[model samples]
Target: MRLRGVLLPAAVLSLTMLAALPLPSCIPQSTPPQPPPPAQPPPPLEVTNPILSGDFADPSVLRVGEDYWAAATSSEWAPHFPLLHSKDLLHWEVVGPIFQTAPTWSEGNYWAPELAQDKGRYFVFYTARQKGGPLCVAVATAAQPSGPYTDHGPLVCQELGSIDGALIRDENDTLYLVWKEDGNSRSLPTPIWAQPLSEDGTRLIGAPTQILMNDSPWEGQLVEGPHLIKRNGWFYMFYAGSACCGRDCNYAVGVARSRKLLGGWEKNPLNPIMKSNESWKCPGHGSVVTDTQGRDYFLYHAYRATDFVYVGRQGLLDEIQWAEDGWPTINGRRGPGGKVLAKPAAFSEDFTSSSLATGWVWPNGRQPTTSVEAGLLSLSPPADRAADPIGAVFARSTNAGNYTAETVLDVSGLPAGMAAGLSAFGDPENALGVYVRSGKVEVWHRERNTHEVLTSLDAPTSADGKLRLRMTAKDGQTYRFAVSPEDTTWTEVGPELSGAYLPPWDRGVRVALTAGGVAGASARFDSLRITPN
Candidate 1:
């Protein structure tokens, strides 16, 4: 579960250094000391099947020269379309969000971001809901791969909704953007449409063409998430089908190929090339990235069967092997089986830094008023606290199936009726947590519009007025809450609670720091420690 470097002992290190040097030429000529064998290179790191640990669904990966970069669907969360970078594809570090905030024209509902590069410019073809319009495909450009990207606004907001904007180049080097018409929403047929992009790859210049549609029995009600890669003179388009979200999802990857960009594309007889196995379920909505050695790999998302859909659809990596027919197979067509995966190290964040970490997000892409100053994180009550959910909330995705999240909140300064606490939040509708008020601690659960206090007790703060809030979940379902004073002992605050009501069908639970109630009601948190069990 833990990874560490093997360090040589000091004596062994000194001897190894001595062996490498010229032996002074006088000490033993009769029996020349043999040079130590060349030090073996470190073994390659073994990354897990779900390469990204959290809710990184509908992942698109781009390999620009030597580095590998990825962007994922952010849904209603802010800092939409988080970009991650990796050197070996085994270890990934978050580069940052492509947009620091949502575009002025879009409100929320971000999904299916595609990462691409052309003409030395890095472009992100992403999906978002326009303010008063339907779901649309938008574009943003950055000079450097790790970006301060400039938003170009929505390109296509079809009557039925347009989503999953993928880019490709034809034999004539003409750029094109392909996306899905979201007819499945109204129980109509969905079509994959392609249109030529302007020189800048921004505007839809040419007339649109319907390249593919939902016609096969296996594809269910829709076909979407089209990505193109050319091999041996054929343009192979990889796409997904069926309900691609929630517990009812039956997603799978299918492929079609054409010699021409907009015509004569034929779906493979073995239409669905990738399907779920015992380990992971409903795998689809991914992109193909060829490595430095020209080996092709598929980066996609799948819900872990062990944790089911509770942890969200995590980003998974599978290799694409070309069969004798030039078609690709993922996981050797065995699915992303139960292979051993590496777990990231547990970390703690104290409010000593000036800026918040990259993962914190708010509901519907709207950030609440918050700040970190003088080694404390202060969350202010929202100006409009009329919403049914907690007034001001900041949260991070939990990657582990079982984990414990603890925060040290300086609750002494909180106003009456205004409480500071920790939460496992699925949306504005669903959450479970414990909060500290003036004279008592209350354990609350929110499902949809209903907010119920599960339990309450007259527990005051510590002598120093600090209270530690702790929330734990096991098997991604059962949850428990506890609170402690300055001491190490934790007192359970509520009955063992089930998290069945917390996770929505699409996203995972976010371990959050919450402040709610009337205006000027707030508290400062000193630190947050997340430990995976």
Candidate 2:
């Protein structure tokens, strides 16, 4: 083969000279081939839709350092305004509630909590109905996200009711409270308003000024859930419009921008920018939170279409992207949900602590009597609560349409009229359970305060009074109960039952450990676990 670069000095060299060229050691050689660096794996996906699995409506999230904390509406439940924490914004756990007891000044109907942090302190701006009065905006302060909050109740109780209180800071670092007037309750048009907040955020100072209203047709008599963020020399306000909940909810989100916090606000031509998608319905009422990377994500609530509103409005996360025209769009204007997501966090409790975890919840003010120690949990109803149908129940919300809730308990001590078991519960009036009492295992359901035993069977007797119970939910509305004798075997306790009547319009079904009976009766639980399908 002829070498392409060999000139040979334009003359043939003698063989002796070529062979004597220092045995080719003086010549350059091609670099030896090296294997390519091993291909790097792509970074794992770190976020998902329904960031929080169940009934976390009207989410307000805040970032501290690299961690995220969220708060949601409690409706009628107390220890109200459930607080959640996340490292990746994918898996979350309940840290506690905004209050360990409902505020004495507010009676029921807790909704739309907004979380914020300033300097070193954390603040929660929330909405609750005043006792014997209209719904009002309120504020609570805490040293930590999981807090013993101090309530500075009812900062704004307008005659028309005030709800959805959010905070914004002017360029001068002056704080303002932004909220919605609940005028739609009387068929009047609703308006979004802003007012100066005291430096400490305890009270409103200046008179409230109207920011935006239901001037557009799609707005349709209501415009609530106001959230504000400043960017590109403009203050952008995000708000939801129309009816907010229930089966016929027409919930949708819209945007407006202005030079200041109060006036000259103009709506985007593409109003109602975020609506329902195939995977979620009635997406609205969210707060925008910025991550450490300077990226913004909207933490909101939406109904999962597969389960309808039975699981309530679940917390969803969508990246908010800015268009070339300086307008923000959620999930690129395709709406919410339809994301490839890992399953939400699974809950398991072993009853190994002296004090119960903060995740357990009961009725708004009806505290359950419970004690945990030495790997066992004992629950009993208070003497005054005997008339309450649900008695003593400790519950946690489940995230999926189909899932299994199981608990191990000892029921040999239960009295003839007393019962204890695991339940799929909506409220005191709506629940399904498999309970044991006085040598009998029965599947019971409660509808409109009426109790019915779907099936009854001989109790599985054990030397130690140990029994296992399970409730499997299918297609979101059907349920089956099973019993076991502390082994691998589980026998069906009843025919498949319908759970269509469990959930009311505003609350999700929770997996509960319930005990209801005569005075002084109690139930002991060994452990509990929940697996979402």
Candidate 3:
């Protein structure tokens, strides 16, 4: 066996002798690894067709068994406190306005409405204020889903300065109400309060206790619209704070949680769960619902098109996931630095009937029962609002860029002034309709509260009351109305509209065939459609 000799250099021996020198404790260390670029925002709801597209603001939703019901504020708009129902959450149909038999106080006071189901009865707790008026809460109840709910008087009487009253029931079956109020107007910030409800769940049984004070910059000057829920032994309150319209609007939803229902609640370390600026202005006033699968969702309203004449508040729904710490995040947007998830599904024409589509909505809560056969839809005239008309077949506007509305309608057997036409109705001064009036097919435009007859033709009228008409819209405010006896023979009766978009009092545009009091006369429609150019 050969033994190898170890050779040590003189410098190595001297360094070893210099001994083990210790480093200074004050020296800083290298930065910790960055948190994997916050897992990219989950994709937006892949909504090929969004259910709501016009002024469906401050929405509140409830999922009862397999059916989902929703309500929204309808400020200054007649047929107030509208309610909508859905089976898939993706396809929603208008059930009825909650306050069809609304009280005298309900006229100008349509605002945020919260819905709840107790026992077998449905309850709608809503708020409203007159023009330049004070806000108050009212309760309405109905046995069936679609309601002609009668008001149960004031939830909180006489006292003013309260809105957005949301209800929640604890595991112990104790009911509570959370709402916003300016209890201290000047010094302290606007806050949210909660109290136990009476055993009946119609009125408050205890005094309101302050649950949270606005402290977040995203909360702005006001903290309102409080909704509470319990999960995992913690009570979570979701609220929207700040104005939510136009350039100045900076609205967002914030949350706080506590182990106890009454105390020790903490403002979420992360807030402004949802927000938008400029392009998607005013994203606030949201509500959450749990689906049958136990998944959570956030239903909110946001402004898409700044064209006040064409667009206002629109409903947006996205999936929500809760953090391990118990705070919920919308579409997984992180604080003020998140993105809105796209809508969840595409609109399908599967449930469509020639007589009525899911998109149709009637003003003042009245819809005409119609006839559908062999691809032809016949609308019977409604008794009331005969001058204004009753039924409309509308789809949510989907003009991401250029907005165009083109449709084919046939007007035969139509009575005089009972027009076969197309119109867009939502905004104050945004209407462009083409129909047969006074025995002639004519095009009319209403811009920002003014009406104009643009063009007309001596179009043929049908003894059978059927006509084929098509109307096309472009930009934000231009339209062209065309008519035809059949799909092949099309004629232009109106010139390119310059300033028509949405007309006041018209809830939505559809193939309107209203009879102006001529008995045995009605209008027949072939096809109606809108295409954004």
Candidate 4:
């Protein structure tokens, strides 16, 4: 199947505007109508199952002390990228975007972004289209690991068709970069190149020297997601190769090793250790990281096809072992699944009430418009910020299974056209949402960023407010939503919504309150709670 570039229509802005309206205070106290009591709380947020499935590709992860950070490629999607973090490898959260400011020039698309922590600062080196033409690496840095990152510099401009770039600082404080040049034709002719970095770890100091070229039949089709790792005195180059779509798109991981930063690298004798369908199918673009234990591990995404064509992916992990010749092998060729992987860390309940968890993202550049008070979160109308006015909250899919999110929203003070809602975001185009709007409630679905209003509710209110909402996700693609004001009255707003999973590279999901049109009315959220269902 061919992957298509998706654009969220401007029509969504009109919808947000049409729904934008100011809400009055609780129904007059003199005529206070007794509202129903609230429902009993759901179970605690526990990891009952896995969180991600289907097509989670080009994963890059960083382990900073007790914290782990990662980002992935979101090709053809605007604000195109995913940034994820974890305490333990199992639980992941969508923290924020690499570029929250209207992306300066991302005309072509964004591929894999390599995240690193140098000294005490966090940096992300990602590829985007330059203002004039071609792909280049834009660098953003922040004081904290999960950031409000600011772009400080740009590199690899001009004639290079760059993608999949990574940074590495050596023992003596030497910095180097390794990446693939896609050669303009969009084919696998792309070759991996490495160059030294300047003192401050910003720009390239010298010309990049070609280190590896695709020659294997398994790779002549394509070679992508180049990641570099230094261990045991060897510079290991990890990359993905072969076609990326269709049954024939044989994506798998390959490794090449060299003694110097730039060198005569040797391809692993046992190349393409991870394959799919023929074995697992479309299993490529793997990222390697060393856990706190100093044990090496590989994290990647792959497609597991069944009877028909279904677009879904599950995150996989495998321990790295040397083949006596110093080449890395995964789970002894049984792949990420056959191995008994060690769990990372667990998510904490003591999150800052105002700031999002370190790693998470919102679709179409949507952000929080409200303030946090007494543990209650409030949101302003969807103003023209990025693309979509509806904001969202997200966390990584810790595993591939079932999960749920619930929150208490006080929309009685909202405007007539305004809405208070919770959304499961994978990308701008792919997500599921349950919301209360225009005095009615509805379920929203999207393929890429295009949406379909699946269901609606007719719950009238005179204004003393609190809407209890819950969204249950069965794996990553299917979702179910329900709302209630009183404990005894529960309304199932809609059946499960259907969509594709956005990789950690593109973006994750978040809960948001939005106005359809230009009237930027605000909505209030009393208690925002999310747990694994």
Which candidate has the highest TM-score of all? 1
Over 1-533, each residue of candidate 3 has an lDDT whose tens digit, in order, gives 11266666777766765677664688777777876666565444444223455567788888988989988876645456668988877667666667654466543556788887777877777876533556666677777667767677566532446777878776577787777775433445776777788766678887878778777777777888777777888888878877665435567877888887667888877677777654465577878888777777777776663443245566777777877766788755632222332432222232236445543443333444456666665655455535542233233434332444444444545566665556655432445566666677667755655666677678775444556666554544555666666456667775676634353321223223332334344555555454444
Model 2, position 289: C-alpha lDDT score = 83
Q: Give every collision pair in model 1.
A: none
Per-residue lDDT over 1-533 for candidate 4, one digit per residue giving the tens place of the 0 to 100 score:
11256554678656666678554586453566878899664432222112233334566788888888877665543344556778867666665556654466655456667787777878788877776788787677778767877776567764657777788764455887777787625543677777888766678887788888888887865677887887788888888887665434566788987777676688887888767643244666767877776667777766544311233344556667767777888756654454222232333322337664443333334544546666565556345532243543333333323455676677667677665677765555566687777778888876665767888878644334777777776644567788877535677887766644533333233333333422556666665554544
Q: Counting only residues 3 or more apart in sequence or on different chains, how many pairs clash (N, Cα, C under 3 Å) in candidate 3?
A: 36
RMSD of each: 14.6, 7.6, 9.9, 27.7
TM-scores of the models, in the order given: 0.89, 0.87, 0.69, 0.69
The weakest ten consecutive residues by lDDT in model 3 span 503-512
User: lDDT per residue, candidate 1, 213-314, as tens digits?
Assistant: 999988999999999988999999999988887778899999999998889999988768888888788999999998886677888998887777778888
lDDT of 2 by residue, 266-303 (tens): 99999888988778888899988887767788888888
Residue 413 lDDT, candidate 3, scale 0-100: 51
Q: Which regions in candidate 2 have their CA more than 4 angstroms from the true location?
A: 1-46, 144-146, 171-173, 387-389
Task: After the best TM-score superposition of candidate 2, give how far the Cα of residue 280 lies from its true spot, in angstroms.
Answer: 1.5
